[model samples]
Target: MIGVVSNSRHASDYSQGVRAMADFARKCLDNWVLTVNGSFEQHQKMIRATLAKRAYELFELRGREHGLHLEDWVIAEQELVHHNLNGNSSGFCILVDCPRDPGIITILSVTSRSLLVFQSRAMADHNPELIAVHLLPENIHPEQTAVDAVDGVLQVHLPKQRNKRRK
Candidate 1:
């Protein structure tokens, strides 16, 4: 009778462990779906704004020479799209080793005029490799922001600029 009781107890414990693991797995899946959906929406918005900003920069780069506005805009859009697809920006890529678990790899916090990237620790720990590219607004200076690698993920804080009204 004692042996049967011991076996029964062991079985109960094993079943409980399995149920707990299943619940955890389900939670992780839900979180992953939400993160991916959010990232896609944010990326769409950023791409539009970034393309316009880059086009303007290109126009300025050519000494403000006239008649190439359309060309500049097209080129800027193409370049930005290509860079994002390839995950390689000329000089704006940050690489870090992250964990395989996914919770929130890239978190974009956007206000009226600024954007911020916040990364979670779990997302940084098991991936073993991570690449992050940050695009800043035209008016904000890069020198004004700060980049820190905490808990294996890169965190960038971009302060927003207030536009002064002209009288």
Candidate 2:
């Protein structure tokens, strides 16, 4: 009887620990943001490659059917741009490692599809100007988005846009 009681207690403790760890992770990710290099143009290339891959998968799913390239591409976009592969709707968080001191930070634009940021450090002798852009996987409310810089890390909290259907 004592052994069974100890096992039950241990299981309860383990469950509590798991919950606590999940809560800690969520809190840590609350201020998470995606950081990008100075190369903004590369985002386009990456998007094209990803889209191509998804489109090809659609083609294979269609039993290697041809002449549906445009349709496949559109379908792929609808699948990927709206929802991630995992289909989790809790929003997305990406952490970007930055310098200890990022200097003056400026946000150029925040759209539903992407974010454009400009950072400048006049005091620095090298690379005084840097432009970074991050492409979002889902549409977000531009007005509701919050951007902040903490400890040289840029944190962007993006709230996903809700879809409303009219009756």
Which regions of candidate 2 deviate over 4 angstroms?
1-90, 102-108, 122-130, 148-150
Q: Write the per-residue lDDT of candidate 2 for residues 1-167, one digit (tens) a residue.
A: 00000112243332222112212111112323223223223334444555677799899999998999999999877654433222247544433334544343232334566654433342433221223435677776655655565665555666777788899
- Total clashes in model 1, counting residue pairs 3 or more apart in sequence or in different chains: 10
lDDT of each: 0.37, 0.45
- Winner by lDDT: 2
User: Which pairs of residues clash in candidate 1, taking residues 3 or more apart in a chain or in different chains?
Assistant: 98-124, 98-125, 98-126, 98-127, 99-124, 99-125, 99-126, 99-127, 100-126, 100-127
Q: Can you list the residue pairs that collide in candidate 2?
A: none
- Where is model 1 more than 4 Å wrong at Cα? 1-35, 39-41, 83-167
lDDT of 1: 0.37
**Native RMSD of candidate 2 (Å):** 21.0
